[model samples]
Target: MSGAHGRRERPPAPEPLPAPTVDAHTHLDACGCEDAADVVAAMDRAAAVGVTRAVTIADDLAAARWAVQAAHWDERVTAAVALHPTRTAAVPEEWFAEIERLAGDPRVVAVGETGLDYYWDHSPPAAQQEWFRRHIDLAKRIGKPLMIHDRDAHEDVLRILREEGPPETVVFHCFSGDAAMARECAAAGYVLSFAGPVTFRNARDLQEAAVVVPEEQLLVETDAPFLTPHPHRGRANEPYCLPWTVRGLAALRGVTDERLATSARRNAERIFGLADVPPAAHPWTGGTDGARSA
Candidate 1:
C-alpha cells in the first residue's frame, strides 16, 4: 500500500502534561537545561506530577521574551517580567518601557520577580533599590500584581512598599525571612510564598514563618531549577517536586495536607488572578475524592 509522506512523520512531540497545583514561582531560564525544549519537557514533567499552573519569571529582556513565548506554548503557564535586583544596574533606561509593553500582554500577569537582594550585592544597593521602586511603580500603574524577591534587604523593601503604596496584590515569593517578617508582610496584606527550602531540617525559622502566616495569605512554590527540597536536595529543582514543599508546610502548620493544599491553591489563585483554577482532587480517589478529608 502507498503511504502519505512516509507515515506522517510521527506527529511531533506530544504537548507536555499539566500540573495539579499552581507553582506560583519559577525561573525556566535558570534551570541550566540546554534550551527551551528542555525547559518545556521539565514543565511537562512537573504537570504530570500535579503542578497545574506556574509563573515563569524573567530577570531581563531576553529571558522575559523566553518566558512569554513559553507561556504561548502552555495554557497553564504564565510570565512575569522585571529586572532582578542583581541585574538592575545593567538594565537600560528604556527597559521600563519594554516591561510596560510586556505587562500589557495577557500572558504577562505580574510585574516582577523583582526586589532587593542585599545578600548577593550583585548590583549596587542604590541601583537595586531604584529598580525595585520602578517595578513597584510599574505594577501599580498597570494595575497588576507584583512578585517580590527580598533577601537581607527586608527593611528597605518594606519601607519602599509602604512609601510607594504597592498595588492590592503583592507576593513575597520564596519567602525565607523570620516569623516577624512574615507577620509584617501578612499585616500589610501581602501573600507569602514558600519554596523548597521550607522542607529543610535547618529551616526552623522558615517553619515558624509558615506556621504563623494566615491561611488566606499563604502560598507554595518550587522556585525551580533551584532550592530542591531535602530528599532531592542539591539536585536541579522542578515544579513536580512542589508537593514536598506543600507537605512540609502542612506539617509545620499542624494542618492536614488537604487543608494546607486547598489554602495554598486558594491563596495562589487570589493573588495571581487565577481564580478559574478548579478544585484540587485527591490522587487516591481520583475526581470523586475532591480535596483530601480535613
Candidate 2:
C-alpha cells in the first residue's frame, strides 16, 4: 500500500540467509503491530528468512507494555524497555518507576533505545542526560545490557557513560560513529549494532567503523519499519529484511555473507541469549478474522 504522500511500498523479503541470525534491535510497536496476532505474523516472516529472533524495543510506556506482551506472544521475540531520550525531556517522575518495573521482567533483555540525541531538541540536553543516567543505573541494577540511541551527541553520551560508570554490557544501537568512535567503543568492549546505513555509498565513515569492530562486539539489526537496506532504501522495512543488512555488512568488511552472519548470530546469542529457540506459537491469521495460539 502506498501512502498518500507517495511513500514507497514495503520491500520484498530478501532471500533466506545462508545461516540464521538475530536482529539485535527493532521496534515492533512502531512497525504497527498491536497485539499477539501481529507479533506472531511478524516473527514468522522473519524466521522464514533465517532471521530467527528479534529484540523488540519500546521507547515509551504504551510501547513498553506492548513490547513486553509481544515478547510473550511469540517465543522468537524478546524485548527491551525504556523511554527514548527525546521522550524523556519532560516526563513525570512516576513513569520511570513503571519503566523500571517493566525492565525487570525476565523477557526484557535490555534497557534502552535511550541515550543522547542532540539532533532533535524535542528534549533539553540536561533532561535527557538525567534520564539517561537513571537508565544507566537501571541497567546496572537489573544487570541487563544498555542499548543506546546516540545521535549528534556522541561525546556527551560517552562522557556520561564514563561519569556514571556504565553497566557491564553497553550497546550502541544503529551506531553512527566514525572509525575513531568505533575504535573507542571497541576498546571499551562495547557492542556496536549496525543497521542499513552502513550499506549506503556515502556512509564511508560508518563502513570504516564497521571494519574495525571485533567479531564478538559486532551485531546487526534492521531498526525496521525504518532504515531499509540498499536497493530497498526508501521502502518500509521489517525483520525479514535483515539478511540484506547482514549481506551488506559482510561485503563492506570483505567477508562472505555466511561468515559474517555466523559471527553476528553468535554475538547476538552471547549478548541477547536468543540462540535458535524454535517458535512455540503459530502464525497470525488476523488480517480479517480469527487468531491462533501456539
- Global lDDT scores for all candidate models: 0.75, 0.85
Best model per lDDT: 2
- Per-model C-alpha RMSD: 10.8, 3.5
lDDT of 1 by residue, 1-294 (tens): 012311222222222323246788887656643344444566667766667778888877777766766565556677898888989877777877887787777777798889999999679999998899888888988888899989898899999999998888899989989999999988999999999888899988988988899899988888876788776777666677787787778888998776777777767777777664233221122223222110
C-alpha TM-scores of all predictions: 0.84, 0.92
**Measured by TM-score, how close is model 1 to the native structure?**
0.84
RMSD of 1: 10.8
Local distance difference test, candidate 2: 0.85
**How many clashing pairs does model 1 include?**
8
Q: Which run of 10 residues does model 1 get worst, by summed lDDT?
A: 285-294
